[model samples]
Structure formats: structure tokens, C-alpha cells
Target chain A: MLSRNQIKYIQSLHQKKYRQQHGAFLVEGAKSVQEVFQSDFQIEMLVATEAFYKENTRLTDRQRTPVEIASVADLERIGTLESNNAALAVVRTKENLPLLAGPDEIALILDDIRDPGNLGTILRIADWYGVRKILCSETTADVYNPKVISASKGSFTRVNWWYGDVAQFLSQLGDGVAVYGAFLNGEDVHTLPFGTSGYLVMGNESNGIGPAVEPFVIKRVTIPSYGGAESLNVGIATAVLLDNWRRTGNLT
Target chain B: MLSRNQIKYIQSLHQKKYRQQHGAFLVEGAKSVQEVFQSDFQIEMLVATEAFYKENTRLTDRQRTPVEIASVADLERIGTLESNNAALAVVRTKENLPLLAGPDEIALILDDIRDPGNLGTILRIADWYGVRKILCSETTADVYNPKVISASKGSFTRVNWWYGDVAQFLSQLGDGVAVYGAFLNGEDVHTLPFGTSGYLVMGNESNGIGPAVEPFVIKRVTIPSYGGAESLNVGIATAVLLDNWRRTGNLT
Candidate 1:
């Protein structure tokens, strides 16, 4: 059962301003909640339905902090979902980290990705491809946005995201770290050196990579399209690039 | 202005039963309505905000039949979106066609894809890749679901989809046509023959390819992971496979 203030607090997180003020955000649904629990992020509060508590006793036993058991109806009242899952949790904001380019690791650099779902999906893609570090333009949607969090589907835990000016970060990268950008016309991904350790950068859905960071790209890669459609979704393009990169053993 | 009955009729198309009964579906938003307007699909009616109708004479000029013009307020009352777009249209459903598979063509076969967004995103991917045909199990989400339509962002006009048993369809295909299924432990996608014309079969988000269709696959492909996560979104996997297939010169 939640008090009026509690409900208001949870609902306030829907907006970025309130989330920033509270220094926390909400994660809903069973799978995401479970993933958050397993992650290092501090779980400020664990709100769960009685049924979820009973079924996930093993998960609860691992909690360093006690979980707050509540009714399904209680969770539903405070949730944004049409049908709230068995659990929801309030997670503290992770510390912001400086964007770091690697000479050996394959990294993903996102330039001005605006959509929350696209950003989240990209994070999940990064997680799947085992690219842990994601450098984002400050204009990119907040990773804690519920839409982004929900779309990431638990991959947020594995991927480290850093928000910074993409242009400045790219210029500072050291030697042997190839910077790859996706463009309409670029070298065929199949022919590019997929085995080398590099930074793969994806751009905005409507606009490709902005001019601010374009000059720093060592190589531009294009996903060859056979159809008449103008472009692929940013998230889809990122996945395609990552898959091709991983496939050819190009990124060391 | 829209009559009460006309508004009710437009709203009824939201339901699958009514959409099927009338053999028409709603295509809203300016770009989608305009795209279908130019396509082969017959336009049943057009409703637009006064500002839109006056400004965009081209779409109205292209209409073979007299288009119904409704006021913004009236359109808003019957619209599905929070803030209605400039225009909306009712389009006749294209006749359901048998799935077409042939030599030297890339195809995508979906097994139990449930999410409207994922299905819609996949359809757009197919359209962008110039994959003309999409085969789906009967359990897949209806293409006309508003969420699916919105997610596809108007690619449905170009992509052809057929619903049937996935296993039966795969079994009937000749040995010369390669059948590739994406899995975690499958052969590395980079080493597989990608450029050749073939069918890429993707499965449900959680469970993956069902057992019934498992044995029919001639090649198993995987998006090799560098991270700790278990899988990529099924839609993302499709884009990855299609892009790699094109990049490898297999499709060209």
C-alpha cells in the first residue's frame, strides 16, 4: 500500500526534472526489476506485489536491503504501465563517468541519438555484442527514461554509458583506435577491417552523424541497402553494424 | 465536418473484426496517408485538418476518387493519437497473397513474433533491405494493429506479408534455398555464406525458434556476443542478418 506522497513521488519520476531532483528513477516490470536487483546500482526501494514476493523468495534472499512487499493493486496504482508487472523498484542515479576511447576494445559511440527507445535498444545491442562502453552526445535521451529503460530489457546493467560532447571525445582518441561512422555512402562493411579494435559510431535517426564529430572518423562504414527506403532505423542500423563488426572479427 | 456516423465508422476500424468486415484499415499521419495515396491501394476516404487540406493540394489532386475533407476538431474527436496529425485516410486492404519464395531472393520468416512494434520494425527492415516477402506464423501479431502500423512508419505499403505454419513452409522449400536460423550457439555469422539469396528465420524474443522448425534449417547463424548479455532483440537480429547478407554481396 502506498501513501499519496509515495504515489506522487513515483509518478513524478516520469519527468526528467523530477528524476534529477530525486536523484533516482523507476524501473518497472518483472524482468527489468530482477535485472536491476542483480546490478550494482543501489536499489533505494523495492516495491513488489505479494504474489511476486512469494514467487521470487530466492531473489529476495539475495537482497542486501529488505524489499517492501505490497499488493499488485498497489503497484498498479503507482505504475505507468497499462498492466503493471509484479514488481517495480526505485534506483539511484549511477555516477556519471568520463567517456573513454579504447585502443584494444570495441566501443560504441552514439552521436546525437534523440529517441529514448532507440537509445535503449542500442544499449541492449551493445550489451549483446559485448561492447560495454557507450559514449553519447549530451543531447541523446536520458538512459533513465522509463521508455529507454523498458526497451533496454535488462541490458542496461551490463553496458556503461557516458554522456559528453562527441566531437571533443573523438579528437582526443589515441592511435590504433579506428573511429567508424555509419554514412549513406561509405566503404562496404564486409571489406572493412572488422578484426581491428575500433570505435563504431551511429548517428541520429533523421540525420546521420553531425558535423561536430565527422572529421574525427578514421573510416566511414555503410550498411549496403538494396531496397528503395531512404534509411534504416538508427537502432536497426547500429545492430547491423555491430553484427557485421563482430562477424568478421574486425573489432579486436 | 464529419457526421457522427462517419466518425463512429472511422473509429470502428480500430477493431480487427470491423477492419476485416469492411476490408479496410486506417492509415493516419501525413507521410503514411500521402504514401498510400500514391500507391495502388484504393483510398476509401480522407480526413484532414483544414490547415492540412488547404496546404497540401498535391495529395488531394492525386486522389482518383473524391476525398472527404473533415474539420480538425471533428478529426480529432475520432483520431487515435493524443495530438492528431495533419491528415488521416482509410485504405482498402490488399488481397492476402500466398507466400512467395524463389531462387536468388532474400526472405525473412518469423516464428511467433508477438509484439506489434517488433513486427512493424521488422517489416520496415525488410522493406529497406528490398526483401519483398515476409512469412510469418499464424500466431504473429496482426499487421494492421495500430501500434504495428505506427512502428512500421508507413513501410507496409511496400512489404508483402503472409501468415501460415512456419514449419510446413520451410519443409516445402528445396534444398538449394538456404535456410538460416539465428541462435546463440550457432556458427559464427561472419564465416557463413551471407551474400547468397536465402531465408533468414527469426524466432520469438524470449523462447527463440520453436522445435518444429529447428531441423529444417540448413545453416545456423549467430551474432557473436562480446558482452555478457544472452541475446539481441529479434528485430535487431533481423536487421543485422539482412545487412550482413547485403554487405557480403550474397544478396546482390
Candidate 2:
């Protein structure tokens, strides 16, 4: 049984402010909830169906995660997902600690990717390519947004992201590291000499990279087009560029 | 001004049934509306704000696309987008024509892509890579779906897709053409000897290539993963695989 106040608290985490205030965020759906349990992130609590609780007894026991048995209706009402069969978790949010582009590491820099679904998909892409650290601009969607978490499909557990002023971060690195930014007309990605490691910057959906971050880009890279799309989705572009990097870098 | 019945008729196009009944679908927002005017498809009518009408007079006149000036509220109400400021159109739906895999053209096969957004993104991805034709499984989301049209970001204008039983289509090709299917364990995409022209089949989001379509695939291709992510989003995977195909096929 879920208390009204408890439901209200969980529901509040839907918004960024409430999440910040509570120092927690939601990981909904059975897969995400299960991923949260296995992640390093602290599980504050779980509202789960009895079946889910019973099936994952060892995992719950291992984490010592406090769970309240709830109905599907309770889960659906309190969670952001339209239909959550199994569980919803309240997990602790990670600190916005600074991240660096390690030597021989292909890092990702997201420049104000506003859509949460796109952000989540990018996380999964980053995870697939083994791009360990991501530097997200302040205007980027909140990584903890439920939509982002749900769309990540458990990749959030493996890939780490740091949110901060990307321009300032890029300025800090200066000419010491190569920064490759995706542009409409630039070096053909097919032939670009991608080094062993660099920072790949993807910009906002409508606008390309912000002016502040533009100067830091050592080389503007573009995937040559054969057809008539005005632009590729940010997530798709990221995967294409990263795949090229991995292929050239022999990291694959 | 939009009549209540006119509004009702336009709103009905938001569903597959009404779209089929009327033999037309919707193209919404300024960009898509603009693209539709420039495309080869027949335009049934347009509902635009005074601003949109006066601005794109040439475009609306180019196709002799009949226009009825309306308020932004009318566009928002009749269309699927939450915020559509400029215009929307009731455009003629293309026939379910049989598309053949051309000798030197890269083609896409969608095996039950369900998400309208994913299907839309794939269309955009296909457009970016210059894939001219796509064969969608009947279970795939309707090409005329407003969400698909919206998410496609106007790429629908350039990409030609045929919807029907994909298994029958694949069965028709049987060993005469190279069919590459995305799989968990298969040939490495990086080193795979990809020909200039072939069919790349992307499977359902969750189930992967259906059993019916599996036997028809000549080669199972896989994108090697370096990180902990379980799988790539179908759109991202399609982009990655398409990029490699273009590169290897010398179609770049």
C-alpha cells in the first residue's frame, strides 16, 4: 500500500526541481529499475509489483533496497511511463563533477541537446561505442529526466556524463587536444584523419555548435550526404562519427 | 478560417483510418509544409496562418496548392504537433507501389519498425545516406502517421517506401541479391566485404529480425560493441551500418 504522501513525493521527482530537492531521480520500468539496482547509484527506494519483488528477491536483498509492494495502477499513477508493469525506483543522483577527455579516449561533447529522448539515445550510443565520459552543456536536457532514463534502456548504468559549461570546458582544453565538431559543410567524415583520441562535439537540433564552443573546434567534420535530409538527428550523427572514429582509431 | 467540419476532417487524418479513407495524410509545421510544397507529391489542400500564407506565397503557388488561411490555434488543434505555428497540409498519400532493389542503389528493408519516431528517424537517416527505396513490413508504423511525418523532418519527401508483406518481398529476391541483416553475433561491420548495392534489413525494435525474414538474409552483419550497452537504437544502427556500406561500396 502506498501512502498519498509517498506517492506525491515520488511523483514530485518527475520535475528537475523536485529531483534536486530530494537528491534523487526516477528509474522506471522493469528493465530500468533492474538496471538501477545493479548500478553504483544508490537506490533510495522502490515501488514494485509483488511479482517483480518476488522474482528479484536476491537483487533486492543484495542491495538491501527498501521496496514497497504496489499495484500496477500505483506504479502507473506515480511514474512517468504510461505503462509500467513491474517497478519504479527512486535512485540517488550523481554529482555534477567535472570530467576530462582522457588521453587516447574518444570523448563526446553534447552542445545543448534539448530533447531528453535524444539525450538518452545518445547515452546508449556513447555506451555502444565505449565513449566513457560525456561533457554536456548546461542547456542540454537533464540526464536524470525520466524520459532520458527510460530511453537509455539500461545504458545509463555504464556510461557516465558530466553537466557543465561546455564552452568553458573547451576553453580549458584549448589547443592541447583536438576537438572535432559536426558541421554541415566540413571535411568528409569518410576521409577525415581521425586521431586515436579527440573530443567530438554535437550541437543543438536547430542550431549548430554555439558560438562560444565553435572556436575550440580544431576541425569541423561532416558525414557527406547522398540524399536530401536537411540534417541528421543528433543521436544518429553522433553514432556515425563515433563509429568512424572507432574504425580509424582501431578501437573496434 | 477553418470550418468545424474542415477541422474535423483534418483532425481525422491524424489517424491511419481517416488517412486511408480520404487517400491523404498530413504535413505539418513550417519546414514540413514548405518541403511538401516543393515535393512531387500532389497536395490536397493547406491550412495556414496569414503570416505563413503571405510569406510562402510562391511555394504555395508553385504547386497550385489550394490554401485556406487559418489561425495557429487551428493548426495546433487539427495537427498532431503540440505547437505548430506556421501551416499544415492534407497531402495525397502515395500508392503502395512495388519498389525494386536497383542494381547500384542502396535499399533499406524495415522489418516491423513500430515506433513512429524511430521509423521517421530511419527515413531521415535513409535520406541522409541517399537510400532511395525502403520496403517496410506491414506491421511497421504507417508511413503517413503524423508523428512519423513530423519526426522525419521533411525527409519523407525524398524517400520512397513500399509497405507490404516484407517476407514475400525478401522471398522474391532469394539469393539473387545480397541481403545484410543486423544481428547480435555476425560478421564485423568494420571489415565486412560489402558490395556496392544490396538490401540492409533492420528488424523490429525489440524482437530483431523476424524469423520469417531471417532465413532470407544472405549474411548476418553486426556492429561490434566495445562498451556495456546491450544494443543500439535501430535508427542509430541503421545510420552506422549505412555509413559503412556507403564507405565500402564506394558509393561515398
Candidate 3:
């Protein structure tokens, strides 16, 4: 049973303002909550149904955070996911640590990716491809958005994301880092020669890479389109590009 | 200006039952409406703002469909999209034609893809890779769903989808066609050889390829994961597999 204040507080984390103000965000549904419990992030609260609490005796026994046994209805009322019957956790948002890419590491640079779902999916894709760090433009969607957390499917725990001015970050990387941007008429990604380490820049959903960040891009890569669609979804494009990069031995 | 009955009818199409009953679905927003207007699919009715009507004189003049000039507010009120300001069109759903695969075409077979957005993104990816036909399990999300239409970004016009029992259809296809299904522990896709013509089976979001359809899959293929993610999004998986197929000269 959740108190009225607890319900309201959980609901408030749905918005970015409250998330930032409280330095906390929500991880809902069984998979995400379980992953968060095993992660290094600090958990402030855990709300779960009796069935879920009973099923995971290890988790319930070793609980370092406050656990509130609630009904599914209570969990749904306080959570963002429509079908979250298992668990919800309030997790402290981690600070953006300085990410220094090594000479043989591939990092992602996102420019104004507005959709939370897309951002989350990209995080999962980055994690799948062993890309540990993502540099986002300040205008990109909040990494802590509930929608993003839901879409990331627990891979968010392993990936680190930092938001800043994308162009400034790329420009200041100096001469050693290679930068590749996805474009419509760019060189075919399959045929393009990729260095072992670089930053692959992906642009907005509607607009490709923004002009301000174009100068920082040393090479423009494209996924060849054979049919009538205008463009692939941003997340899909990123996954395909990363697959090719990894397959062609571009990532160490 | 939309009549009250027209508005109600448009709103009814939001539900799958009504769309099936009416034999029509909506194409909302500027990009989708424009694309549907140019497609071979017959448009039953088009509602648009005066600005939209005036700008596309060719479409307005050669319109065989009924045109009703409507306000942007009306479009937003009756449409599924939250921010459609330009146009909406009622398009007749096309009949599912018998798809015959030549020796040079690669097609997609989807098993219970429940998310409309994923289905739509799959259609766009299929269109991009020149896969013109898709076979879906009867339990797949309706292709005519407004959410699916919105996510397809006009590629819905180019792709043809058919829904039936996936196993039954594959069983009937006999030994002439190669069937590849994505599995977690399957053969690595990059190292696998794909023929020019075959069926690529994609499965459900949470549950992968169902057991009922598993026997029909002759080849199990998987994208190798280098990082910690357990799986990929269904739509992203489809795009990556298709990219690999096309790049390896498996598609003519």
C-alpha cells in the first residue's frame, strides 16, 4: 500500500523538471527494475506486488533500499508503464562523468535526437555493439525519461551517456579522433574504410546531421537504400551502421 | 469544416474493429497524407486546411476523391496524431494479393509482431531494402492501425503485407524456398550465406519465434552481440538482417 504522497512523488518523476529537481528517475516493469536492482546505481525506493516480492527472496532479503509491498493497482497508479504489474524503483541519476575514448574505442555522438524511445533504443544498440560512451547534444531527449528507460530494456545500466554541445565536444577532441556522420548521399557504409577508433555522429530524426556539426565530421557514411522509402528510422540506421562497423573490424 | 457524423466516423477508425468494418483507415499529417495522395491506393476522402489545399493545386485539381476543406483544429481533433496540422485522408485498404516469390526476391515473414510501431518500422525497412512483400501471423498488429501508419512514414504505400498462419503458409511453401529465422544462439548472420530468394522470419517482441513456427525455419540466423544486451528490437533486427542480406549480394 502506497501513501498518497508517495504516489504523487512517483508520478512527479514522469516529467524532466521533477526528475532533475529530485536527482532521481523511475525504472518500471519487471525487467528494468530487476536490472536496476543489480546495477551500481543507488536506489531510493522499491515498490512491488506481493507476488513479485515473494518470487525474488534473494532480492527481498538483501534489500538495501526501502521496500514497499504494494498491490499491482498501486504500482500501476504510480508507474509510467501501463502494464507494470511487478515493480517500480526510484533510482538516483548518475553524474555525467568525463568520457575519454581510447585509441581503439568507438563512441557515439548524438545530435538533437528528440524522441525518448529512439534515444533509449540507441543506447541498447550501443550497448549491444560494445560502445560504452554516448555523447549527446544538449537538445537530445533526457536519458532518464521513463519512456527511454522502458525502451532500453536494461541495457541503460551498462551504457554511459553525457549531454553537451556536440560540435564543441567534437571540435575540441583535436586531431587524433576520426568523426563519421550518417548522410543520404554519403559514401556507402559497407564500402567505407573505417578506422578502429572514432566517433560516429547521428543526427535528428527529421533532419540528418545538423550543419553546425557537419564540419567536425571527417567522413560521411550512408546505408545504401535500394527501394522507395525516404530514410530509415534513426535508431534503425544507428544499429545497421554499428553492425557494419563491427563486422568490418572497425571496432576493437 | 467537418460534419459531426464525419468527425465521429473519423474518430471511430482509430479502433481496429471500426477500421475493419469500414474497410478504410486514416493517413494523417502532412507527409503521410501527401504520400498517400500520390500512391496507387484509392483515397475515399481528404480533409485539409485551406493552406494545404491551395499549395497542392495539382492534387486538388486532379482529385478523384471527395475533398472537404477543414481547419487544422478539426484535423487534430479527429486524427490519431497529436499535432497533425496539414491534412488527413481516408484511404481504402488494399486487398492482400497472392505473393509469388521469384528466384531473386527476399521477403519477410513476421510471427506475431504485436507493436504497431515495430510493424510500421519493419515496413519502412522492408521498403528500403526492396523487399516488397511481407507475411505476418494473424496475431500481428493491424497494418492499417493509425499508429502503424504514422510510424511507417509513407513507406506503407510501397510495401504489401498479408496476414495468415505463418506455419501453415511456410509448410505449404514446400522445399523450394529457404526460410531463415532469427534466434539468440543461431548461426552468426555475418558468417552465414544467404540465397537471393528466401523468407526471413522475425518474431514477437517479448517472446521470440513461437514454437509452432519453429519447425518451419530451416536456418536460424543471429546478429552477433559483442556487448551486454540480451536482444535487439524486432524492427532493428529486421533492418540489420536485411542490410546484411543486401550487402552480401543475396538480393538481386
How do the residues A171-198 of candidate 2 rate in per-residue lDDT, one tens digit apiece?
A: 8885669899999989998877799887
Q: Per-residue lDDT tens digits of candidate 3, residues B101-207? A: 66888989999999998999999999999999899999999999999999899999999888888788888886868899999989888777788788999999999
User: What digit string (tens of lDDT, one per residue) describes model 1 on residues B66-168?
Assistant: 5667766666667675566488888888787777666778888898899988998988888888898999898888888777776788788888888888899
Per-residue lDDT, model 3, residue A192, is 78
* CAPRI classification of candidate 3: high
Query: Comparing 1 and 2 by lDDT, which wins?
Result: 2
In the predicted model 3, the residue pairs found to clash are: none
CA error at residue A137 for candidate 3, angstroms: 1.5
Alpha carbon deviation, residue B35, candidate 1 (Å): 1.6
- Give a tens-digit lDDT track for model 3, residues A1-252: 678898899999999999999999999988898888788888899898888877875874565788899888888888878887899999999997767677878999999999999999999999999999999999999999999999899999999988888888887887867899999989998777778788999999999899999999999999999999989989999999999988888333
* Candidate 2 Cα errors over 4 Å, as ranges: none
Q: What is the TM-score of chain A alone in each candidate?
A: 0.94, 0.97, 0.96
Candidate 2's iRMSD: 0.7
Best by TM-score: 2
For candidate 1, chain B by itself scores a TM value of 0.93
Better of 1 and 3 by TM-score: 3
How well is each residue in B1-252 modelled by candidate 2, as lDDT tens digits?
A: 778898899989989998999999999999999998988989989999999999999889988777899888877888889998999999999888999878888899999999999999999999989998999999999999999998899999999999989889888884769899999999999888898887999999999999999999999999989899999989999999999998877733
Candidate ranking (TM-score, best to worst): 2, 3, 1
